[model samples]
Target: MNTLYPVMLEPQEPSGYCVQFVDIPGAITEGETLEECLFNAAEALTGVIESYIELGQEIPRPSENIKEAYYIAPDARVQSALLIRWARGDRSLADIARALETSWPSAQRLENPHHSPTLKQLERAASVLGKKLVLSLE
Candidate 1:
């Protein structure tokens, strides 16, 4: 389940770009430069995901409306989380739960895209998968 959402970048006034995710309405931001806009978009997307998870709301499934829209990759948090789950592969969820010192259902919840995972949890999962979760800003 790729969470890369389609983003519509609308130029505003003389020199700024306003970006909005098609599937997750209200997740939008503007920046004076393309680089800044992407950085802010990543922040906005992560906030939206965290809010939905906190409120116990389901994060809407991404639409196929990317026809003419540019895609924004999921934020670092999401990327790391998904990576941990994907790396789990043939490994059992129960095994993951045992590794995380949690229950099976809780482990499954970690794999849920709508649920935002804590950095510590992600690192633990990555460690269990024999992978290292690294983050760098550029």
Candidate 2:
């Protein structure tokens, strides 16, 4: 199934930006500029989807009842990544919320894959997760 989720971009100091999957926790991409960040985001999303499919897990479907939401064409590659993450037993929603200094509900929304999270929130989440946020020129 194809799912559309909002990506939130935030500007950083020195000249760079970051991207995050609004609905998926710990899914983030960064770039030196807005355009680059978006490009990278698309790639990351693809990878996540692919990973999920490979694991033979049920990929989450976006709510059909909602309108005005953009769906990222469902890609097996991106789904696979998400599946793997789910299997690995990574940070929980409450854990992430406390780490990011946000509330449980807000963090839950970030995991919805339908909500958009701000860039600043992404950066902070990355830090908490011990993931490196990178911005490339290419």
Candidate 3:
């Protein structure tokens, strides 16, 4: 499932915008324009959640009435794929590893945000988990 994070954007004094995510503490960024703010917001949110996933911490649910919602994209070849797949309760690391054509340790590392995986490998793992990985540029 795709996770949507709510962000609060405030115009900074003089210039730029300060972006803060409600559910993701320590996730803050700034941009000179709305476009840039939106882009940075995605990056910040992704980074926060990816860190949480990497640390095996909880991913917070979105709060109510979030005006600006950002999509979570911690890179398709990163831990987000493994987190999503595991969250589905459809398979174990061993099962996903076999489908990914890699070792179990590699499969486990696929869930580590600090460890990058090949996009092809993430795609294969997503397929095995019955998910279609969608990636886009802002």
TM-score of each: 0.60, 0.43, 0.67
**Whole-model alpha-carbon lDDT for candidate 3:** 0.69
| Per-residue lDDT over 1-138 for candidate 3, one digit per residue giving the tens place of the 0 to 100 score | 545567777888899988888777888999999889878877777677777776767676657665555444445444464455456474688977787788989888767766776777667767877877676564
Order by lDDT, highest first: 1, 3, 2
Question: Could you tell me which 10 consecutive residues in candidate 2 have the lowest summed lDDT?
Answer: 76-85
lDDT of 1 by residue, 58-120 (tens): 566667666778667666656554565567878999999998898998787676666678878
* Residue-level lDDT tens digits of model 2 in 67-136: 4332343343233234223532566878877877889887665444434556566556556767644432
Clashing pairs in 1: none
User: Per-residue lDDT for 26 in model 3?
Assistant: 81
Candidate 1: give its CA RMSD in angstroms.
Answer: 5.7
Q: Which one is best on TM-score? A: 3
Clashes of each: 0, 25, 0
Model 3 regions lying over 4 Å from their true place: 61-65, 68-72, 76-91, 98-101, 134-138
Sort by TM-score, top down from the best:
3, 1, 2
Model 1: weakest 10-residue lDDT segment is 76-85
- Those runs of model 2 whose alpha carbons end farther than 4 Å from true positions after fitting are 63-138
- On the 0 to 100 scale, the lDDT of residue 87 in model 1 is 78
